[model samples]
Target: MQKVASKRWKLAEKIPPEIEQALSYYPAFFRQVLYNRGITSTEQAMAFLSPGEDFHDPMMLLNMAGVVERLLYAIDHHEPIAVYGDYDVDGVSATALLVETIQLLGGNVTAYIPNRFEEGYGLNIEALGHLREQGIRLVLTVDCGIRSLQEAEHARQIGLDLIISDHHHPLDEIPPANFVICPKQNGDEYPEKNLAGVGVAYKIAQALLRQRRKELPREGFGLDLVALGTVADVVPLTGENRLLVRAGLKELRRGGRTGLRSLAQAARLNLGALSTSDIGFGLAPRLNAAGRLESALASYQLLLERDIQQIGMLVQHLDDQNRERQKITTEMQKRAEELIQEEGFEEILFAFDESFNPGVVGLVAGKLTESYYRPAVVGHINGEYVRASCRSIPAFHITQALDACADLMVHHGGHALAAGFTIHRDRLAELKQRLAKIAFEQLGDLDLRPVLRADVEIPLGELHPEFLKYLYLLEPTGMDNPEVFFVSRNVRTSNARAIGADGKHLKFLVTDGWITYDAVAFRQGHWMEAGLPKEVDILYRFEMNTFNGRESLQLNVVDIKPAGGD
Candidate 1:
């Protein structure tokens, strides 16, 4: 196993006096936390903590007027429509959201999610032709097809009307579809640019519902799906995206969706008390497992299933598949790490082999990036072609780098920090060389180590149980909006022991002389082998832990080091 990389802890600067006075009613810690998130005034803090559903007008999206008009006309004319979606959680949930919206609107609609191993990502000529043959007159994509320039032309040639709705970063030129909905596209003025694919679909659903205001099917019906995809896609939880997820969490906890309820039961999560962490670590992975191992159709169908028995069966299958996925990811990540150790870390890491499962290559690449704090590309070589997933750090714009090497790739598209591509196996060497050159140009002079940002540094005694309530104000935290972490230095440790089935978690008691609290450092059990230091510095999240009906304050340690060792 590779040694853990030492992280640099950057503490947030103290809040300015004027802003602190503006937020004077709030606790000092909460005020600092809010300021750290760019909340300056009382209005901004109030709006952030208790956001109202003042969602932006969906019509603001470019081409949304035409797309909604076309869709309403299709409903009136009884035209067949297909919602083409990708196979990941974001894609599958977006597919379900739009399909259900059209069905509720009384339009003849069906869902089309291509098999990952077979059709690959995004819109494909073959899938479009198949949909056209089925007498589908219109195709609307969700969570994909922002870069399907050729496929859009193919659809038009086949006399199929296409509306592309995707949140991925588009290339210099977009598809020639009848309508395109993307905030990042040129000439678009949508305020929220970080929406997940399912989010874009929700906007379409909103526009469709607005047209039939008197016959609105339901309120917040699709927000659960929106929340699932938005969180699963790891988009920034801020602005409108934050409001959608907050409302979606409420909808999810209501247990209206049978498939999601069944999934929650299987995952041992209390649906009534579900949080974003549960979605990110528990439910999203299970839903993604179906696509990662076999086919995502099962997941898409589960979301729409009304039968209890069928939902149970699907949830069980997903659970089994998720377990298998974990095994495969662990093995593949080990192999990738071994390869990196043998070849040494490059500007960007690459590990490709025929034996690597295409389904889990992205996961392996993510693991490598996380372990080494660098961009990583892991691919599966199949015959003459290699398909790869790239995970990158902030220093590098992964998609732009791929764009620099476009001539060497079959096709590629994704966000700045994550991307996917396929290239002829023969040109793999040139692609790597070009990509490394691009990465080195941007990242060679930077300090590339991982950073752990703490909102404040204080004595452990100052952390009170009442502070937990203030922390709860920042719910639905992920990606850009993160959970607050604190740095407590010169803390003494005692009763240290390795816990967990694999003995990979360190459990101990920590104190700053006056106040003592139980702390757990996950995956830090190796510290015991080296002898636990009597004095240590820890960066952790302070929260309440309930064990056997007893609730007590606990410190969830994120990183630990010997006191004053730096």
Candidate 2:
């Protein structure tokens, strides 16, 4: 188990007085949070808070004209098109988004989600042959196919026109497809370089809408799916992503998609008041469960399903699959932990197992990164090949590290924090040796403890009602931007008790002399067992907790320590 003292609380930097005093119009403490986000001016702050203030030009992407021309040609010619997508939420959502849009523009389209257990990721030769047999004349890949150089060649050989739309780091050699639209491609200038896979797909749809001279669906008809995939992939919630999510959440609150509405009901969520947490923690997990343990078609269909009965069955089945996936993940995580302890974990960790599922290794790597605060690689050894998934810390870029040793991999690509690759099993030892050396070289002197940064240090008594409302102004925060958190010093824990199933959480009554608040710390029940100090400093966020028809502000404590240190 990780030690509790491993956390470090960092106070936000203080800007110049002139900068802070100039923007005295907004809430002071909340404005400080904006300042921390590099917003020194009121205009920047307003644009960040409000959605739709600025929109990037979709046509600016490199080869946007070619992408539009080929796709439009297929649509006009009435040729069956395939949207080959990954099984994860981002890929599936992009597939659904594109398929629906093409159908709206009168085109024959089918979505294909590669089976994780069989095809792994991206294009496979056998799937291509099948698509050809199914009369798929043109292929449009959503969220995948960037690195399928050889497969793209084979598709052309078989008389298939392939258009790839993906958002992953490309290797030296680009694919041989007709048109590849990725922000990372050379000469591309889409402005926001950090769009999720679904975000890229949405841009294509938006471009197609403009090409047809049609008004964008007022609700961004496809935007709800955008929000689901964007949050699920954990992309930086800034730039165009923030605008899309801000609007998507409003659309989700309307509960228009029958399948998504059923999913909300099945998850026991209030559909009318959805938030980022509902998508990331609640909905995205279920959607990913389908891809992890079963064929992702269930999720892809769920996104488009209008039949209420089928939607209910699909959600119930997905919930069951998610439970099984969780159990397997727990077991694998325990084994991985044992291996890490046995080997003595370093700045970077590598774990391999024949039994590890390729579909779930990313999740395991993510868990390992969170628990150990280090970049991690978890892979499944399949015969002579190992398909590995990597999760990274903010201090290190795992993809760049993989790039440094790219020759050994069959194909490797992904973003900074999360990536995947396939390599010969024999190269595992060399890869480990090379990566450990890189880790030491890159992170030898840097502290690895997780740092929790608070917006400002303020007394609990200073939290006025208006200030709480102002906090909501910074909604849909993730990645680069974070939710509001404040530090309160010298607080007394009036009462502390273990709550939740098996007493895994700490329910406490906290006070700062002037007022008392009901506070709960999830997954921190050990604090109660160790016994809280008489006086302590706490990092917390306020929330409106509803119980028994009553609503009251509650302290969602983030971290705690003795009054002087954290």
Candidate 3:
């Protein structure tokens, strides 16, 4: 893990007196965290703390006017419209959101989510042909079609109009669509650029609302779908994204959608108190597991259905698929580890197996990259080609590197952090060599260690329900605006014991000079036998733990290090 530089508290430098006074209710350390994250001015602090405000104008997004005009035309003309989306949680939720939005507007609409294994990502030619045959006049793509230059061209050839509302990084040449609403597109003027796929779809929904002069739905009912996809896609939760998720989470807690309620029940989540962590870890995974292990249609159906019985059945199927996905992901991770060990990859790691499922390769590759903090690629070998998922550390841009080696790839596009590509199976070795060389050259002198950024340093005595409540102001935390992690130094573990079913969790009591606290570290059970020292530095987040009808405070350990060591 990366070692963060220690610094004195600097809240006074950033926070205004009024904001600081308002935060006086919180512990000094919690106030410092709020200040450090730029919630310093009165308005900024208030907005961050409240989260109900800070919405962006839907018209601010690029192509909102064009998209709205076209959609209105389609509604007025009674044209058959199709919503094309990708298959992940973000894509499925985006599809559900757009389909429902258009249906509410009285437009004849159908939805399409590409099959991961059969059709791959983006616009598939066969699917487009099928849609054309179904007399779909306008194609509005959600979460995909940004890179489908040829597919879009084919649609144009067939006299079908297309509009793209995607968040993926665009290639050098964009497809000729009727309208495009990607923030990252060159020359676009959207203020919040780093939107998730669902975020873009939500913008489209917002545009429709404005066109009709409709009141923003009560408590943002549409936001529940937005929250699921925004969190699931792991987009940075800052700016407009934070606002959308905050509202969406509120809707989710109130049980806005029956489909979401059914899904939460299937996942055994307590909806009343659901947090971003629960959605990202529990619900999103089950939704995504269907796309990985089986058909994504199940997940889409679960989200779009109104029938409680059908929702229950679909949730059960997804639950089973999630279990199977876990098993396959574990097996794939083991095999990837073995391949890394056998091949002795030093600066980069790449693995391929014909039997590996393409849908799960990305998950496995991500795990491998996290395990080693190296750029890793996991691919599924086919007859003459290989499709792979590439995950990189913050220091490397995998997609740009793939772009550099475009000569060897069939097609590739993604963000700087994660990407996907296809290459001739015969040239897999060459592709790996080229990518490794690029990564090594670019990241040679960089510190590859992962840094755990502590929001603030806190004395154990300062932890309380009030402080925890202040921390709740940073709701819907992900990517950029993450849950605050505080570092406590020179603390001693009073007692430690292995807990949980498989003894894979560690529950411990820690004490500083003036305070004692309960702490739990999941997947750190092996540390129990490592012998706790008298003094250690621990990185942790404050959480409200409920057990047996009782509520108490707990420290969720993120990392631990020797007190005086680097």
- Clash pairs, candidate 2, are none
> Model 1, which residues run further than 4 Å from truth?
1-4, 214-217
lDDT of 2 at 479: 82
Top of the candidates by TM-score = 1
- Whole-model alpha-carbon lDDT for candidate 1: 0.91
- State which candidate, 1 or 3, has the greater TM-score: 1
TM-scores, one per candidate:
0.98, 0.97, 0.93
Which pairs in model 1 have colliding backbones? none
Off by over 4 Å in 2: 1-4, 215-218, 547-549
Clashing pairs in model 3? Answer: 2-450
Estimate, for each residue in 1-566, the C-alpha lDDT of model 2 and write its tens digit. 35225588889998678878766777778768889989888888777777563668899998889999888989999999999999999999999999999988899999888899888898998999999999999999988888899999999999998998898877677899898999988878788888889999989998998899876555458889999999998999988888888888888888888899898877777888788988988899999999999799999999999887888899999989988999999999988887777656588888899989777899999999988888899999999999999999888999899999988889888888899989999998899889889998998899888889898998878876667677788888788878888889988887788999878898888787888889898888888778878888889888887665578888899888888873
Better of 1 and 2 by TM-score: 1
Could you tell me how far off, in angstroms, the CA of residue 91 lies in candidate 2 after the best superposition?
Answer: 0.4
TM-score head-to-head 2 vs 3, winner: 2
Q: What's the distance in Å from true for residue 170, model 3? A: 1.0
